[model samples]
Target: MSKISKLFKGSSSSSSSSSRSKHRSRGGPTPQEAIHRLRETEEMLTKKQDYLEKKIEQEIMVAKKHGTKNKRAALQALKRKKRLEAQLTQIDGTLSTIEFQREALENSHTNTEVLNNLSFATKAMKKVHENMDLDKIDDMMQDITEQQDVAQEISEAISRPFGETFDEDELLAELAELEQEDLEESMKSMGGLPSVPSSKLPSAWHGHRTTTKKRVEEEDDMHMLASWAT
Candidate 1:
């Protein structure tokens, strides 16, 4: 009997869980529905407040009309007015609270929408940045620069002057031969030039040297005459 009871309890618990899961699958009321409900409540509370206010005003008029004419009637009317006033005050408080609740709900709903938009924007930005990498960008730029340099070098090579080519040693040999021929030509030209006579010294220079030699000879003769006189 105990085992059968345990089995029944397990079956019941399983069914309850399945039912709960089914209930969970059914969606709850949305914020719009909740806000609508709040508005309905606010409307009801406002109507109640209006009714209480009207009733309080009617009791006041009755009390004023019966004033001093029927003291007991006036007193009873005033009492009724006070009770209506209290009810109106309570309704007013209820309406204020309802309005506050509705405003809070609206703010919450707006915040939810704003948060969703921000989340979407964040996801979009993340996706945009996903395909970008600093390292890859740097490598790509380097490859581009290298390609540009190679293109420039190729362009420069293609734009070279189309002139004769010469081997270095051959060019040097040719240059030496040309220089030798130039020297030979210069020597031939010099050979054809007028020659200076070996004895073509200036007359003043020759006179100066001859005058010096004669003065030395005269001095030697004077020395010989002095020796004879002695």
Candidate 2:
């Protein structure tokens, strides 16, 4: 190539190399992404391995079929079988590596998720407690208790009878005084009874009998009233 052409080619190659390097240096795939890719690779490798196994079997059968009848043919078939087996073994190793990598990535993903959840919970708890303290909580509880006590007192007051209060002993004493006054008024209203005459006259006798009957009736009335009062 000419010098200019060579220089242009070098520049292109350098540019391509730098781009590849940058791609390689970019942030790695997430665990989920890497595991997905590993699983896909494992599946592809498994299919290849299966194909190789079938090929190996076919080669073995070919070798057997040519066994003594054609030594050269049998040798070629055997050689092909050996190559197929080697490829299969390599594929198996690759599968094992892929499986291990996938498992490691899964474990790492689970651990990361758990850590994130724990961090979230911690932040939530901190936010909830930001404006609170033990002293404030205690004060709130005390206030609640005081309010409850006040409510209880109000309830008790509401439940009581709505009426004027009176002393039982004082009421009894007043009633006794009223009964005494009634008895004295009854005795005074009767006034002095007519004096009994020593000498008997028909008129005097009639008057004495009438007075006695009236006094008896008054006594019976007083007894009945006293009984009613009691």
Candidate 3:
């Protein structure tokens, strides 16, 4: 309304702003500090309450001591005790309110921290899932399944039996019959052969002829053993 008042108001506002900045620079009380302050106040109130209780007890003793002897003194002591009791009641209420405030502040601080952590975790999960596409994953899995089926079919084809089946007994019977025919043909061919006369041959030729006959006999024995093994 006046220049002086306006100047005073502006100065006052500047001072308040400076004070707030100073407080901020000093790092104003956190929830923990506030809770600590409340606890200290609560403790102080409890101590005061105890002092009042003790005072009330002393006044009661004084009232009892003076009750029969001095009525006036006894009335004064009773009045003091009543006043002390009132103070104690007031302290109790104050302590209750401080404790409630401290507890609420602590709960709010804890909830704030929990919400911040949850928010951080949610952002991290969002970033992680940003690279993923469910449709691409599904398509890749389907392709893998098809490839596995194709591989299974190829494996089956590779392991399949390739030829017609024949009985072991029938094969053995046929081999024995072929051996019998060979034996009969050999016996007939030997029977029609002319025997060598060693007396008319040269000594070296006879020796060679004897060795050839022995070798032929050994070959026949080996062939017979092979047929038996088969």
Give me the candidate number with maximum lDDT.
Answer: 3
Order candidates by TM-score, high to low. 3, 2, 1
Instruction: List the RMSD of every prediction in angstroms.
Output: 22.0, 13.5, 15.6
Model 2 stretches astray by more than 4 angstroms: 1-25, 162-230
Off by over 4 Å in 3: 1-23, 26-28, 165-230
The pairs that clash in candidate 2 are: none
List TM-scores for all candidates, in order. Answer: 0.51, 0.57, 0.58
Please, what is the whole-model Cα lDDT of each candidate in the order they appear?
A: 0.77, 0.80, 0.81
The alpha-carbon deviation from the true structure for residue 84 of candidate 1, after best TM-score superposition, in angstroms, is: 1.2
- Per-residue lDDT of candidate 1, residues 30-121 (tens digit): 68867876786676567666666777889899989999999999999999988888878887888888889889989999999999999999
lDDT of residue 195 for candidate 2: 68
- Please give, for residues 1-230, the per-residue lDDT of candidate 3 as tens digits: 95535654765686568657756887676777677767766776776676778889999999999987899999999999889888888888888889889999999999999999999999999999999999999999999999999999999999999999999999999999987777666656656334767467888988898899889877875765575457
Tens digits of per-residue lDDT, candidate 2, 133-181, equal: 9998999999999999999999999999988999999999999999777
Global fold similarity of model 2 (TM-score)? 0.57
